[model samples]
Target: MEEQVNVPQIFATDPKLFRFLTKVIHDQGLTPGVEWKVCEGSSRGDNFIAVIKQVVHVAEGGTALNLLVKSAPRNAARRDAFGIREQFLNEIDVYEKAIPRLKSLVGFDLPVADLYGATSSHGEETILLADLKELGFCMADRRQGLSKEQCAAVLRALAQLHAASFALREGSPEEFAALAESVREMFWTQPRRHAFEPFMRNANKETLRLIREYYGSADCDNEYSRAFRQISDLGYDFLANIVTKVPENKKVLLHGDCWTNNLLFKTNDDGFVSAKLLDFQLARISAPMIDLIFFLFTSTKPKNVGNYLEEFLRVYYEEFERRLKTAGFTAAKLYPESELLADWIACVPYGLVVAGILAPALYCPDECLPNLESVKENSREAFVNEYGKVMRANTPESKEHLGQLVKLCVEREWLRILN
Candidate 1:
């Protein structure tokens, strides 16, 4: 799947993909009277879950429209192990149902990519979206993480989204509950745990190993070891229950995966970095702290995190409060600043677990990324375990990512309860 796949080669391998792309174009009223071809849209490490390609269209006088189309996985092993179809359906459901409803409820436009159409027909699942690159946006270098300005931009965007979820929840409880029902918990569900358990256990073990290596004595029944062990021991139900069993007062739909790559940025006319959210595959109903903590750990410069962690909290809270206030709800009564901070402290373990999962995708350069589809292995567990081994090869970038987060957590006493 990582090989150089030309248009003809792609169509030859997956014949029906072309038809689906064409149908999306026709239905979306895009590239009227133009020929189109599928071409590479992103590099290998930029995206992993979907087969992404650009539907490049050109007319007689060179009028062009370049849109991005994401389809299902091509490999059966990857498809089944990752439950690509289920995630695709979840993502499509968010775009088709949740986004529009949220927009209407919030009375403002969210910063998501403009989706043209989505479909899950026969053997093909695809979503057509206007390309952000075509609109003067690009990804920051993952190794460096987002700058303070970029992070503030992302946090502000996240606040608006979390606020919108709160608005929907308060204004229409039944409707909000219905929307929550449609979002399938893609990551930590029972049926898919068989496939994800090996990955999770191995990932947790690797992180614990790194913790011991970094601090040299963080093992031996210490908090660091206990934290990762708790996650690995509890596994699926532990993680799933944190999300699916949320209290009514603590509920808000989370952008469950908010790693660096899932966000795109451009400097607006106001000369500030602004972000557009991407990837709803992991969208689920949960508290806002999960999203906030995950992004802060995995996507911000670790140095900035230790120094400006409270600043980040303030930025998000002020915006969240503003949005809630506008909707005739008092943020103090609904979710006070003290409670948000306390909840955020408690959610650090969740952040740590998810940040380990994000490390490979966040820090692995295109040159270092492996093609999971082509890996030779006996079963999903073996493949996932091997993948963890490869990803945790004592690479400086990833080790620093883990080390800095752990250090910050320790300094803040966020991991103290693990003991």
Candidate 2:
């Protein structure tokens, strides 16, 4: 039997927490005497990541270091607060298991802080990690989505990470399974299913309503219209398909949550490439294509839809094929590259619904928060003007491609609304 992993134990208890952080720094060749300061302008919540400023006490001079002090939200009134303690602990497992493996691929690609277990003076669990600001880093603002350069860097990093896993599984199945087991629940659990159900229902309703208002009765017979009306029902099916229908043997690690906000970017002085990545909290074992489609559709404008996406997937497959060959893993016949376009079509609708629901939340200003009243006033024309390509709606190619994607999901028996 595979080792029975205990999630809770992975987190350090109160008394042992400080020592863990100190030990992590020491192991990394930094001195033990360190100063800690919380990062400014961070959001607070139950189980939210807290940032801290740290300085290692050096013999010659203590240089400043920015550290992320990750903590679980301890809010009592929150209904969605179950198992938060386990969540933080799970994050530790993710960092410990994936980071080292990923390091070889990206060569310090991500601007994440060093994570060492730590506890507070009053007996609370904490994690000490790197600070983005200390490295002169800030995440790409979710308002504008990723710039072309940011997309390229992110895609390259993803390709490398995916390649590393392909290499591992191909070379040493035992080792790969062992690591995956440690963090498997990070992605697969349906703990929030109850809360998510209502959210998804509302999303589906809104999608159809929007479609009706925008297109009028003329295109009601269109496949795209039919698909939009049934997106929400498909979400549950998707969840079931990905989580249950797909056999365990076929699964690979996924980012689980691959939205742009979850990603961070580190850029050079002239705003060119440096490194980027963040929010490993949702890392899990799943199909890799989900991550790619999720990022491209939700985080990019329609103008960026085709060629760049094609190139990115090509690069991923190229890397995947190379690694598989190196490890003597010849499953090329099983997962043929020729099937990519078909898979892409199948996956695009999933991206569409996700992107539609998320576009408001990710891009909205605080003043335009998604209150019922605001939503009532927010017309489809405004939404399209803000994010969609007006030209895309008129173009024959865009319509056909977009319509085909929508049609497939509808035929697959997806529900009318999507969350």
Candidate 3:
């Protein structure tokens, strides 16, 4: 005899949502007595994510299913104020449309979450997905950073992702164009960009202060300092004008926010076996180096990046070329290693700026996170105030991370490009 499990109270609270879940379960040919319990997710994500453990009773036995439910904040004002509705739509588009196209074009499943269903209306949206944890996939610790093998696995996965886009562009140009047109650059949108400008300016100020404090006044005007100062002075304008600009020639669908938290790794006794990308809300058509640099600077440890930078680039490029060739395209004619390296060099400042803004939030304790409720009530002022609190809370770690990043940039003569 099978032990009976009671329905969780969490699922009982929303009859409408429960009905949707019931339908989804039924559509999969599972028996109906579905019960769910809430699980934990990221604190910093714009939307609310609830990992629900669902138990379904069939004729022979009862099986447990873990489903990830992501929903827009209930407050409509907050959704509009933060432009979260648009972000949610972008993610929905990627999962519902882009992923299917990629699978058909590339003849394989891309490394992303399997979506069960999604709903969007006006300011509200909800998505249900298979919880990756059920498949032994877990997030790498953002604070600790990734090991070399883990980093390699991520690069390889990213290579495959990028190659799929290239193949799509070659095989079905119109379809690829339509897919690109469907998604917008989250950071470049007017409302979100306005909200982000103040944070960028503040981050620049804090970064400059850290540089001077660490390097001393005597060294403050050195090559690195000069380059940092130039960008800091330019601040948000630099971001708007240069960093976010898309090169016409080498655009690909980017994972936009390619940090550690956005990635999940499954490891076995030997090592990291596979990885999956999450958070497509920021996905956009852009230079592939944007994703590459974002991942390199914000996710991996400074030591690993310093030690294996060239090797990592090689792994990504080689895998990218191999995939492109497998997809019946000449890798050399389409995207050579030389061009890739050049694009990376050109995008170093973009990586630095992103790391500066992301480090504080990534390092801050959960208790130190901004009160989004306040932002919902008073968007701009509340957000800026909370941003300051977060930045102050994580200053020490942010400084250390920024210092290493700046040092790496200077050593590689990446600062010379500023001249």
Specify the poorest-scoring 10-residue window by lDDT in model 3: 45-54
* Clashes within 3 Å, all models in order: 0, 23, 0
* Per-model TM-score on C-alpha atoms: 0.88, 0.69, 0.89
What lDDT does model 3 reach? 0.74
lDDT of 1 by residue, 1-419 (tens): 53222345566777677666556655655444446566787776677678788777664466666778888866566676567888899999999998899888777788898887888873488898888888898888887888999999899889989888888888899999999899887666777677666777778877777666665554455555555566567666766676566778878888888878788999989897888899999898888888888899899767888888889889999989998887777788877888877887777777888877777667665566756656776465654554554465555577677777777787777765565
Candidate 3 structure, TM-score to reference: 0.89
Off by over 4 Å in 1: 1-15, 28-38, 59-63, 217-240, 325-328, 365-367, 373-390
Candidate 3 versus truth, CA RMSD in Å, comes to 3.8
lDDT of 3 by residue, 1-419 (tens): 95343455665665666667667766777665644556545555322322223333342256665677777666655555566778889989999998888878776678898998887765447788888877899887677778888888888888888989988888888898999899778775565677677767787777777666656653356555567777677556556544457655566788888888788899887764688998888898887888888898888777788889899999999989988888788778777888877788887877888887788766777677766655544454455465466677655666678777888888877666677
- Model 1's TM-score against the true structure: 0.88
Give the alpha carbon lDDT tens digit for every residue of 144-251 in model 2: 657677776666566555656655665567867887787645323476566445555665555554444444543354555766655555666564354434444445
Name the best candidate (by lDDT).
Answer: 1
Worst lDDT window (10 residues) for model 1?
A: 1-10
Best candidate (score: TM-score): 3
Higher-ranked by TM-score: 1 or 3 = 3
Off-target runs (Cα >4 Å) in candidate 3 are 1-7, 43-60, 189-192, 216-223, 234-238, 241-244, 371-380
